[model samples]
Target: MSFGAHRPMSVLTWLATPVLFTASVLGLIGLGGMLLDADWRVALSSALFGPAAAVTVLLAGFVEWRTVRCRWCLGLGYPAVVFVAGLLLGDVTLSSPVALALGIPALTVLGVLMRRERNRVIPIA
Candidate 1:
């Protein structure tokens, strides 16, 4: 059942992280320039590349999520937070307070559920 030492995922999975990281750097740079109000090109590049950067970050998060062990917490936490943030991005004024209010209670409940689910036994009837 062992493929190799220190290589849990496939070769492509290993390659994907760095490739996405390198490709996303240009987009991130564009975003920084846009933030500074540098010029039209900066704005254009940021508009064009921002989604790529966001997607790359999400992909990286997903890859990391799969590596940890948990009934659900390890994999779901990052994406769940990201989803909530995205959901609230349109109303930035209220996003922080809302995220905190919603996130804390939801995560607390999730932790309790995870603990409860961890040791469930199914009868082999």
Candidate 2:
């Protein structure tokens, strides 16, 4: 079970997942901010390059690695969670930063738990 053969593919798969997740998160937040009177550029800038975005991506990647062993499942499912989170939080005002801040970690953890439970109930082999 050498990881070498899968190393490149794994890295590539892992990288692509988070990038899209980050972008989707940022887009959602930015859209919310804009709806709340913030400049679109500022909102986008705040999300596109910041500690929060980095942390979200990093945490999501960790969840993907730990629970969703299949890269393809991770690539699809992880973003879907974030996507729903974003939509649910779409109306959150910018003043309430805590809600948005908590969403990333909360949803990431949820995805991890759900994936693990799924694997337990229905083992692949």
Candidate 3:
């Protein structure tokens, strides 16, 4: 129940799933709009959100599979997968300066957390 009790990396991995899933779905809708109207704005919107979703879901699934928590995995996995698929195949782009800025910090945090967790799990032998 407490934040400190749970592994930070695992918790973040789980959290990212829903966020990515939502972004993917929204991106898809935006892509659809672009397709219907041939507008760059719609396409750009879709591209931006879609990849964000995919990354989140991917991280979540990776965590779930690694940790073997079915409930959490299922809760996070399906949406993330769907979003990723949409991003790849849907009429959306996945590149942005803002995304690059945000991704670096997010990835760094995850790496740090994972490293800390790994240290905790290893024996000092």
Q: How do all models score by TM-score? A: 0.28, 0.29, 0.35
Clashes of 3: 2
User: Poorest 10 consecutive residues of model 2 by lDDT?
Assistant: 4-13
lDDT of each: 0.39, 0.46, 0.50
Model 3's TM-score against the true structure: 0.35
Query: Mind sharing the TM-score for model 1?
Result: 0.28
Best by TM-score: 3
Query: Which regions in candidate 3 have their CA more than 4 angstroms from the true location?
Result: 1-76, 79-85, 94-96, 121-125
lDDT of 3 by residue, 14-125 (tens): 5554444444444445545544654333333435545555565555533524445764766466555655655665564443333334445555555665566666552344
Tens-digit lDDT string for candidate 1 (12-109): 34233332432334344444545565543312233323443354344443242343464155334433444444444433322233323443444455
Q: Rank the candidates by lDDT, best first.
A: 3, 2, 1
Residue 73 accuracy (lDDT) in model 3: 62
Query: Each candidate: how many clashes?
Result: 0, 0, 2
- Residue 26 of model 3, lDDT score: 44
